[model samples]
Target: MDMERRTLLGLAAGAGMALSVTGARAQTIADGGRAGPADPTEIIRLWPDGTPGGEGVTVTPIVPERSTDPAFHDRYAQYTTDPILTVFRPERPNGSAMLLIPGGGYRWAVLDKEGYDVARVFAASGTTCFVLRYRLPADGWAAGADAPLQDAQRAIRLIRSRAADYGVDPKKIGVLGASAGGHLAGLASARTDAAYAATDAADALSLRPDLTVLMYPVATMADPYVHAGSRTHLLGETPSPERIAAYSLERMDWRGAAPVFLLHALDDASVPVENSLQLLTTLKAAAVPTEVHLFQEGSHGFGIRLIQGRPAQVWPDLVRAWAARLDFPL
Candidate 1:
């Protein structure tokens, strides 16, 4: 079933024709009144009036396009001026929710491999999920590096404000991020201040996640183990020392933060295992309940991606168990 879905990118916007190139089953696209968590929903804008700092940003070409990289055949949503959430509901409500953040090195949002596919897996376990389509910093948002977190914080508040609508117990809400998205998740968890000014009542709800799950994330923006592409995209080509220090999330404050679950592959060439290790160390110092697993293989961006005989494929269950131990069961 997963294999079939991979080949089929929902709604071929370029051709403006059939939902898929091969007529495979398209993922459902319902909206607010949908009766159940198992069904997926259409996009919901985080800012109905207008996204702050994105007032003049050009937002055309919004439909998700297939990845051009031959080796990484998936879809990415770019030029996203209207940062929003795509819902993936559970077949049975577990009274919990997660704001799902995918990664494309902060250049775009990978919708399938890191999002829809993974969300369905958790939703099947009765956890309602919302996949975030955040604004990219390089796209000229005035907030610069803070744009993604703005979208993230807003998404979390949205979920909390509409908890009953989604059948979620607001207290059980958390975050799950991958690669660069993981960095944003970690930032969201540690932040004691709002990323953006209050736009509505939802802003009053806590933006810090009840829990955090980072999958081979871009942990440090500092020194040796930095994911250069992510750093450049978020902080520009030659960011100042202050900027570097600020975004190096592992070294940042984790006060009042939620417990975290870290997953990475020792052989992850793109985002080195040290990223997770550094975060683990800080989390321990901060006394935030933390769990970590460094698999010998399965490298980076393995978002529930089943590599035959590889241990990273078990990440979803690992996350499930960790959350359950914290009493925020998935």
Candidate 2:
């Protein structure tokens, strides 16, 4: 096979063991009772009793799919009525935790490419990774535009509450989000306010991530820089000015926020690079420790897939370097 073909094949091989199976409700990952390379150590249902703001709204069951073509292996799951954390534990953990949030433009969650695939990479660095399968706003969530952020907040608290169980230091937790998911993380980092009403004791735990990493995020909800699909699904077509200001990360109040690391491609056709640029400007103004990398290529979200000649392929390793540079234990 040629280099491109080989790279594609390698990506497919990375996900095959875990992506081949199917399930209805949240369950442990297994492939016909056989061991799988990418199977999560645990699949934790975030809301066991009932999801807040989910009353009267019928939730759709999760449906996962992967393309048959080896040339283009795409793995994703949609209609996530049950929000869960798919845990990927490192063989030799260094007591750090990272919450990986995949992006499907807020329509679905990219399970393998962004979730499982990226988890293994971080896991290799002795960092425990939690791949979050959060609730989508367009899925008729009663929380509307805030539904996704609510789920994000809950996940962080849940992890912090059981920090010992996951073998992670409670204070060393951070978040990594791609595309629209980045938008959610960005908003969450801006303020320590609660996204939903307190339901359990876990809610008392902080939702602020110790560190924030955004990959080609949709940071703005306003014109000239908004990712239309993410905005429409999140805030609807005629969102009020207040709502727009609320979701736009660059325009939000970010004082005392956690340090942010951003990655974006100048040639990205999906989300404008200015989204990160403007956000970078805002973070500096607020005195938030920020680092941004703008690549000439690496078009869009590839999630650790080593494209033959792309500089973005090195992002996976760069995470550990960034953490070390800032004296963040990894």
Candidate 3:
């Protein structure tokens, strides 16, 4: 193996061993009942000097809100005052990477299903994955709707800055997000400038993702199809028209935005499939390379599990093929 690949694999192995010693449990898969790869190589805080607008904020232990449901226990994770990026390195280094952002309506982050489970799938396919546990806007942790976007931008920049250490090509880095996390990813893709003022050297790097994948995302803050909970959580109960327009992904400038792959189920009532469709239209109009799949019955939040046995479960393969088409080294 090349030295770069060897260094990454060695780091991955060490991370697994360290997780074992630290008593961090492996994430459980959705359908197969298998476990996720060992805990991440490292959990780097998004802001080591304390997050902006996070003064006097205290962290509470993450408690599964729907503890009675096995699915919830398997998928949900909450209460994150200190946002971080959990690095999951692949055994086979492909010089590509993705930063995953989980969704909980901007109220909490779904660390297991949308984060770890998805990470395992991509990592297994040779892409190093970093699962971002971003700060929630509902927690009043940051100033405005830009808090999540700030974290997303920082995560991308940090990954790019440390790409060599992780055997990743900075140019091949992408961002994937689900639900509200998808909104954050889309926003980050369109707005690459640092949302918050530069606090350190990492901020000097570009936040633009090379590509983007958004699954069942809340694409717009407008009504008729808006996920009310997500909109309210991210922008407060009474968001101004200007704020709503600014956060709407469809309205953002698409200049220099990365190629995108979007997947959503038409029957999704929670987020509405129109979210993806609207964004697809905008992307197409802007002449951005974009591909979209609207499933007939996969509902919502299906992560990497099989949904109705066929097309839904095949999204990962589609994503792989898409990445290959883009020559992303995956």
Candidate 4:
């Protein structure tokens, strides 16, 4: 076998060993071996009154699940019934902010690997981060696929409206998501109308993100290239053609969509690299400023884990450089 392939296998083995040692102790060591207050700096409810369509919805607590082999343990907190945004402020303010969305195939939110872990990195880079724990559609919370999108739109508007309070520039706010969360981010960027009726002043603010970062995102809900599990979870077993076409972000209107930075592994079996490719092509055709990084290895869901070495771990640096070029209000 080639040296690079061999090296990847060795790294995988090392990760396996680490997982074995850490999987059982995931809860205690979730904060990267550092102990801190269990509560977030601040937890702001998305809705002040009551969530629309969430009147009689029942939500189960999000219990962390350990992986058996190829997949390692993802340390997520309890699933919350009310949607909220957990604030993580930077020591040095850059005037820019990001809404972090964790992916769990519309069933749950991967709050640790994809949410808090990513927030810490960006926060250190001088950007305020808000990790969104949105309501899942698979739990039968709201009717159809509207539940997750509504929460996502509300989260963006909330952050933008309160930009002054959080020491953020309203024009420099962006959205970042992984897998299914990526799909929601793209939807929030492209869709112009509100998913739910505006009940308060927050909804009056725009939900569009100034920029977007998608890590191994599920870009489409259409046939052939669609991730079956995500599509099934978001849309029911049999969805109308109109709904499918509407949710297919690559096929959506890109007129007011934000510039995007996409990263996907060539060997991503979960969401497939084609998902990123399709979105990139569409963005390029629409003259949207876009950057994409496709690694030869790394599989999927590697998230902040440096198991794949320099090539895969350099995504955050690439994003930093990309943001610099944009001259964001940092």
**The best candidate in terms of TM-score:** 2
Per residue, candidate 2 scores C-alpha lDDT tens digits across 1-330 of 123433433454454533321223322222232333635435566777677776656655554445554443355667667677877878898888988898888888787777777788888878888888888887777888788888899888988998999788898899999998898888778867887888889989899999999999999999988998988988888899899888899998889988899999899999999999999999999999988888898887867764445788888667678888877755
Better of 2 and 4 by TM-score: 2
Model 4: colliding residue pairs: 62-79
Compare candidates 2 and 3 on TM-score and give the better one: 2
TM-score per model over all chains:
0.86, 0.88, 0.86, 0.84
Q: What's the lDDT for candidate 1?
A: 0.79
True lDDT of residue 271, candidate 1: 94
Per-residue lDDT of 210-294 in model 1, one digit per residue for the tens? 9999989998998899999999999999999899999997889896689899988888999989899988888888999988988
lDDT of 4 by residue, 1-330 (tens): 123433433454334321111111121222233232233435566775766675566654544545333333455544446676777888998999999998888877887678877888898889999998887776656555878889889999989989999889999999999999999988888888888989878889988999999999999998788989889888888888998898998998787578899999898888989899999889988888898989998887878964346578888888989988998643
Model 1, residue 238: C-alpha shift (Å): 0.4
- 184: Cα error in model 1, Å: 0.6
Better candidate by TM-score, 1 or 4: 1
Which pairs clash in model 3? Answer: none
Off by over 4 Å in 3: 1-37, 56-61, 65-75, 306-308
In order, what lDDT does every prediction score?
Answer: 0.79, 0.78, 0.79, 0.77
Backbone clash tally for model 1?
Answer: 3
